[model samples]
Target: MTQTTPTTPVPPGALDGTGESSKGEATDNRARSRAAGPGRLLAIVLTGQLMAVLDVFIVNVAAPTLRADLHASGSGLQLVVAGYTISYAVLLITGARLGALIGHRQAFLAGLTVFTAASLACGLAPGTGALIAFRFIQGAGAAVMLPQVLSLIQRTFTGASRAQALGAYSAVLASGAAAGQVLGGVLVQADLFGTGWRPVFLVNVPIGLVLLILGPRWLGGAEERPESRAGGGAAGRSGALDLAGLLLLAAAVLLFTVPMVLGQEWGWPLWGWVMLGLSAVLAAVFAVYEARLAGRGGAPLISPRVAGAPGMPLAIARIVLAMAANAGFLFVMTLHVQGALGYGALRAGWTFAPTAVAFGLVGLNWRRIPARWQPVTVPSGFLLAAVSFAGVGLALRDGSDGGPWLFAALVGVGTGLSFAYSPVLTRTLATIRPQDAADASGVLVTSAQLGMLTGVAVFGAIFLGHGPGVDASADALWATCLALAGAALCGAIVGLVIRVGHLR
Candidate 1:
């Protein structure tokens, strides 16, 4: 009865819960090897991100062609652009959460598949309504995919490697955004595959296909941390989902953004104000709910705890303000180029090329820029941009038709440096805890989207209220420049705050 075979007991900490460290020295070695090796997966992810960002500006250059072919009204055209943006912005928080719940790699692949299919639908849509619908879907896919790219890099790499990856990500963003207008112009003008403006959407299909094929082989499996698997069983999956929070967030964004996009077109009707009021109420309610969830030790959609972090909210505010000013500048400049200068779409697109080139070049050197210099860069960018805007106003006032090239070049330099701010915000955020990273990213993106929405609305109203006039060109340009200068001043103030805070 006492003949029990002696068994060797496993030592404490032998199994490091999630099995992340259980692979021992060999696993660490492998991770280091992968980190040092050329990352095919990273490249694929960046390409997808580049495509998503590019789509934001690509259609701007093709708007006229789309209007003619689809017989879309001015509102319809705005919807084509706004639809994607609003959808993407709304889903960003939810997407990040979902990616965390299911593996990031799986989420990325799933999003790519959806986006690729939606692109096909967009290209094939017979009318404006259909196109707008598909664009919304495409944007939703983009929301899901974009977050995973950042998360995967964060998970896969460490230290200097992480910084390098982020820098590369930044470079892709700058280059893709700049290239969009040029590529769209070329594609639209060429009438590729006899598809009119359809090729712009269709071009994504091949790119998506390549990503789908290579993703499985290159992305590797999800590396679950010990804490992630602590609860075990269905609890692990349930912890990931956060369904109620996601629904509330989605509702909050829709209620807010819909009015902003549609209110001007509808003459700011009673319904629109009602929606806005509802949105504010819903936002408040959502905030309370998230707080309660956090208190209960449950994961909220955005995680209220992170919002309370020092510098996070301030960073978000700065991002929103800067983006608003930038968007307004673009809106006014577009009109100035096309209406006042009488330049065609292709020529107007080309005018912004120098900015793109400069941005790409500067973005590559972002890694070397110190964190302390980040605040400085923002103000400097705004100052340069303000000067460029002033130059435009001066030229318009002087009735000089031919010197836009020089003014645009100055704007280009400003825009190039403008590329640094977001990355700077990202870098500042790297100090945050891992669990809060997704929320930070979401906040950063949401602020930028809101800024864009506000910018378009405010600047569009200013431009339209003044009415179209050749003689009024100088007045319009001056008014826009003053507004931009005001924005720059705000950015400067924020930079000062950052500097002072650091001093403390």
Candidate 2:
């Protein structure tokens, strides 16, 4: 009998001279690829986030130039700013759903692309109407992009990694806002590309281009679900797109915001009142529709359950009120310095730099504050902000020259304290389900935007109605600051309630 040696078949690329080396090299490549993947995605997403946040403030310094160039009136100027914010707020929920349905990465890229194009259109806008319309579209795009950032970070990372990523995200958000103001000032001052105020919008083009190009490669596709992988459920979740709900919400916001913004300018016209009535009706209808959907187990545009959560609505209300006060303070300060005090735009922009610097410094050490101290810090910060506002009021009353510096420093300190707990709020909300997180964030942003719009309108109305004389302006500003202080007092009360209720 022949001795038969059984030859075992080696696996593909197993141990042939270079085969093991090749396998090891392949493994190394994959490990490196995976390791680099999330970081790359984060960078791209943060860039997009930065762009979105930047747009919010980038136009502030350029507002005067834009107004002059486009022949826009005060109302038109408000539209230019408020139109974007209003549209952005209305579309946020829809955008989030769209991202979930179509795909986050695809949606993010598409939104970025649209936003970039709209930025160009805004730069080239031939008239005020064109600029306003384009800004609305740009805002729509931003609405789509911003939510996915949170979604992406949440879905991608987990555990401590997720916390760290979120912290970074929050920091980027603050930095982007601060940078927008500074960069807008610089660009307007420098007259880069000779585009004048247009460069503020145009600058987004290159940054956006970089994001669009790199995004797909870095962001990967949406996470594959277990059910999706098993092919046993809908590929993406199944729920109607809620177009009716969306339209109603849009109508409601427009009816409410348009009238609020234009009412004072148009002398509280019949049309404004009509729109206000219509807005109320639309809001009621929206509520009914949402309730119906909820009862049917269909996903409502917003989750009523989350919205109705204990303390959440109150928390949001306080946030809105506080933001409204902040907006009024900013508006009055801007007008006082540039319009009344005859300071140049550059000088005015520089005036706020101290506040920004202080905010950044405090924000850097935010983590050092104990968790238990967050409740105290938030209210204390508000109190400080109120005091700062009062200081400005006093400075105005005293007719002190170069007084904005002291007030600005106080503002910086107050802002730093005010934001100290934002991270804590974010983490607390994150513990909720993903959809809840989305709903909560949407609600918070909406409240903040509305507060800002309302603040400007209310404060501006008071100022203009009384006339913009030095004394009148000063009085209006002081009253506005006092109102904000009242709001901070309210927030403090709420904080106490939260602490007490939690104890109970």
Candidate 3:
């Protein structure tokens, strides 16, 4: 919550440190002046932020519809939904580095342009394969644009203004997520001029275009690259890209993700198991290589300092698990309500609104609690999530709606997850020094994306792996919910360890 102070105000021409510095600085200052107020800057940042976050969940509501229209296989439908996350998670660190290298404002706008174009492509896709490809591109755009948001806030605002801006960031996250569900449903049900599921994606086009126009007008260039001023290590290799690290990380995720996603449709083939096993080995290799890179004074893809900060890994793990379980629960419920129960898309979408609202409420207000009690909330939240997940499974087991109990369980799960995630993330970032903010942000964001990706792939597999039949699907969901509950318990255990170490 403390303001990052490394962003000393740049006198005109200081940012470029070049022969034509005056022109660049004048241009930068003029842009900054136009969007001078924190309100204007945050408006631009949060709108892009909302669009990026909303895309992740919006597809969930449209999944069943996509399947019907595209004639997508079960795995294909999952691909349509998850392919964006795959590329997004894998490329996020690279995207952060890219933003740092080529000016944050430019990166954001370029990325937004790519995202908008890809959304249009997704809307117009002729087949499932094409749609899946476009989704990956869309995710890439998000990865590029999103990391700059916090950087911009850190640069443009100070003190109380910065804190409020950060609050707005959090609010947008909650609003975007909840709004995505309801909006996706409404758009689908209305069929938007009979466009069917396409509108869920097409909706981004106009908004993206508006942001694209406003982005250049509103956003100012600061020390978008924290390394330039904060620390010496990152400065040493300002232009370096970690090719080896990118390869290893991508391979590891792909090995694990591809198998988990396709194994169900592929009948749990031997190759899938082999790939899954290999992923662990690659992950270990990635870790070792990154430590060596950082130790050699190179800019590693992920900073070990940020990741290995006191009590940081444990705190981050709790969030990663919490995210996985949270995403998994949403995916499974969508499957149940839309696929098995035959609920309309709008009705099914409404079912998730309570969870999103509850999560937003808890996340936004947890700070009001006494500081002393905050540590326990992490573990306690996970424990609550476990119970809520169990209740949801029990409620959903019979084909009929679990009625009020279902909604209540959803609300409880949302609250539990908000407590588990939001506080831990704030504390986790607090562990990093200002110079390392971008890397720290990259580590946390990449991990969160990875968690969501894992949840969708693994939980989707667990739910759909069972042979066909409503009874079979329902039984699979119960088992998946139990599995998710176990994951939350693990998160709780991790949180307790963090507390025992006095790492709050």
* Better candidate number, 1 or 2, judged by lDDT: 1
**Alpha carbon deviation, residue 403, candidate 3 (Å):** 1.7
- Cα RMSDs, all models: 9.8, 12.6, 6.7
Which portions of model 3 show Cα errors greater than 4 Å?
A: 1-35, 73-76, 156-179, 222-226, 232-237, 465-474, 498-504
lDDT of 2 by residue, 338-427 (tens): 776776667666666665555555544555667555445556666666666666676676444446556564565346434633443443
Q: Give a tens-digit lDDT track for model 1, residues 151-202.
A: 6665555445555676677556645655787678778878876788999999
Stretches of candidate 2 off by over 4 Å are 1-36, 73-75, 171-179, 223-237, 308-311, 361-364, 401-417, 435-437, 497-504
**lDDT values, one for every candidate:** 0.67, 0.66, 0.73
The superposed Cα distance between candidate 3 and the true structure at residue 180, in angstroms, equals 3.1
Q: What TM-score would you give candidate 3 relative to the actual structure?
A: 0.85
Greater TM-score among 2 and 3 belongs to 3
The Cα RMSD in angstroms, rounded to one decimal, for candidate 3 relative to the true structure is: 6.7
What TM-score fits each model? 0.84, 0.82, 0.85
The pairs that clash in candidate 3 are none
lDDT of 3 by residue, 190-246 (tens): 998878999999999999999888777677544454456444224325556677887
The better-scoring model by TM-score among 1 and 2 is 1
